[model samples]
Target chain A: DVKVTQSSRYLVKRTGEKVFLECVQDMDHENMFWYRQDPGLGLRLIYFSYDVKMKEKGDIPEGYSVSREKKERFSLILESASTNQTSMYLCASSLTGTSGYNEQFFGPGTRLTVL
Target chain B: AQSVAQPEDQVNVAEGNPLTVKCTYSVSGNPYLFWYVQYPNRGLQFLLKYITGDNLVKGSYGFEAEFNKSQTSFHLKKPSALVSDSALYFCAVRDTGTGGFKTIFGAGTRLFVKA
Candidate 1:
């Protein structure tokens, strides 16, 4: 079975603080993604990495950055956390082949609270 | 742009009763549809997907979804509802014709099964 793990399940940070959320997948997938889930907003993509050191912005990538120094690890960084940034962060990974029909495997998610 | 829509915000069902979660999508061309279920405090789990071929695709935990090309819908269904099945459900879509590999998710529906 494929397993995806996040560094933190829940986190609290003050305004203007830098926050880092980590995700790791054991399936050796080539594509990794970061998304913020909010009520009525669904899962909006923040950033995605197709390969090491490669990143692309998604629908809502403001105030967020990503790092993919290695294949197994993907990190989401908040330049300066704000109350509006509080959300459930999700990480997913998928294989590159099959004409992009691959199903993404997700991590447990990190619920971040910014005060 | 690819997008997915989950019309219902919540669905309530009694245990042992059949349950259905509605999902509709719009894309440029042929679509890859997906259904995911999220337990409390857990990540979204892949329930099923429809790429091509069979219109009805079966997935984990007795869940299935039907792909309707004419309607542009992929509705998730289960024969029996369990109290344990109560969770948040999301529908996703990816445009196969578009060269982009990004997938869009719906706002999500909360499912409640009463015993």
Candidate 2:
């Protein structure tokens, strides 16, 4: 089975603290994405990496950053955690081309709470 | 600009009743539409997608969606709703203008299936 595993299922952090949420996919997909899910707002994309060391900002990338040093792993970084940043973070991976062939496989998600 | 809309914030249905979750999208170029389900405390899972040929797309968990190109809608449907099917549903459309790597998601609709 294509698997995407997150480093933490739940995380709590203090305001102004630096946080890292890791994600790894066994599928070796070429594209990876990070998103934050909030009530009523649904899922908002934060960042997308099409290849190693390449990234694109999504609709809501203001308070987040991402790193993809390797093909199977992607990491999300919160430079300065704020109470408003507390939300469900999700990571997903998909195959190379975007021509309707990409089916994103997602991790279980990391529920982060900023205190 | 590309966008997705799930007009209803919540949908209530009884067990064994047919359920429909409405979705509409606006995007430049051909629209690659998708539907996802998120269970409590879990990440979103791809339910179905509409790319080309057939208008009706069958997906996992006895769910399906019909693609209406002329109407710019792709609504999710299930013949017999199960109590376990209660969850959050999201609609997404791939942004071709943004190189098709970014997917715009709807605000999501909470599904409540009463026994």
Candidate 3:
């Protein structure tokens, strides 16, 4: 079974602090994505990495960044935690080719609360 | 623009009754539709997908979705609604002819299964 795990299930950070959310997938998927979900706003993509050390900005990547130094691990970084940045952060991994395009395996989300 | 839409924000159903969550897509080429479920405090989980061939697609947790090309809709349905099935559902579509592995997701629909 495909398993995606996140470093923390819940996190609280002070304003202006740096925050890091880690995600790892057991399956050897090449695509990893970070998304922030808010009420009524759904899931907004923050960043996605197609390969190690390669990254691309999504719809809302302003105050957030991501890293993919290893195949199985992807990390999302909050440059300066703000109350507006608080949301349910989700990590997902999927295969690269068309055959595995639509289905994404997601980890349990990390709910971030900035104070 | 290629996009997916879930018109209804919420759907309510009584236990043991049938339920349906509506989804629609507007994209170029053939559309690959998918359904995902998110339990409270959890990340989204892949429920089912319609790639090709059959219009009816079955997925985990006794859920299934029907892809209708004429209606540009892929509504998720289950014969019997269970209280445990209450969750946030998302509809997504993979853009086929856009020359990328981009998937557009609906805002999401909350399903309330009443016992």
Candidate 4:
């Protein structure tokens, strides 16, 4: 079975602190994504990488950046954590996007609380 | 611009009763629709998707969704509900733009299954 693992399941950070959330997938998928899930906002895409070293901003990418140094790992960095940024973060990976295939498999999410 | 809309904010159903979660989508061409379920603090799990087929697509954990071309809707349903089935359900659509692959999610619907 394809497995997407996240570095932390729960995290607490202070305001103005830098935060790093890591995601790894064993399926060798070429596409990796980072999203923040909130109550009424759903899962808003923060950043995505189609290939190693390639990244693109999603709808709500402010104050967030992504790093995809390897094929299997994608990291999301919060430059300065704030109380408003506290939410559940999810990481997903999908097989190389094709004309017809784009099924994303997600990892266990990390719930971050900024104090 | 591609977007997803989950009509219901919450749905409550008794165990052994049928349940439905409604979703609608907007896109330029034929749309790729997806359903995911998030439990507690876990990541969203892929439930089902509708690319192109018989409209009625069966997926994991006895869940199925029917795609209506005319109405541009992909509504998820299950014959029976279990307490374990209670979770936050999300509907997503692929944004087929030039930049890269991105999935747009809707404001999730919380499903409460009562025993």
Tens-place lDDT per residue, model 4, B17-99, is: 99999999999887888999988867788998888879999999999999998998999999999999999999988887744
Checking candidate 1 for backbone clashes, the offending pairs are none
lDDT by residue for model 4 (A1-115), tens: 8899999999999999999999999988999999998889998889999899999988899999999999999999999999999999999999864554577899998999999
Q: What is the TM-score of each predicted model, taking all chains together?
A: 0.96, 0.96, 0.95, 0.95
Model 3 lDDT per residue over A1-115, tens place: 8999999999999999999999999999998889888888888888888889989888799999889999999999999899999899999999876575748899999989999
Error of model 3, residue B26, in angstroms: 1.0
| Candidate 2, residue A48: how far the Cα is off, in Å | 0.8
* Overall local distance difference test of candidate 4: 0.91
Candidate 1 structure quality by residue, lDDT tens digits, A1-115: 9999999999999999999999999988999999999998889998988889999888899999999999999999999999999999999999988665588999999999999
User: DockQ of candidates 1 onward, in order?
Assistant: 0.78, 0.75, 0.70, 0.75
- Identify the CAPRI category of the predicted complex in candidate 4: medium
CAPRI-style docking class of model 1 based on DockQ: medium
Q: Residues A44-105, candidate 2, lDDT per residue (tens digit)?
A: 88999988998899888888888999998899999999999999999999996646357688
- For candidate 1 chain B, which ten residues in a row score worst on lDDT? B94-103
Residue A53 lDDT in model 3? 97
lDDT for A17 (candidate 1): 98
Give the deviation of candidate 2 from the true structure as CA RMSD: 1.2
**How well is each residue in B58-82 modelled by candidate 1, as lDDT tens digits?**
9999999999989989999999999
Best by DockQ: 1
How well does candidate 2 match the true structure in TM-score terms? 0.96
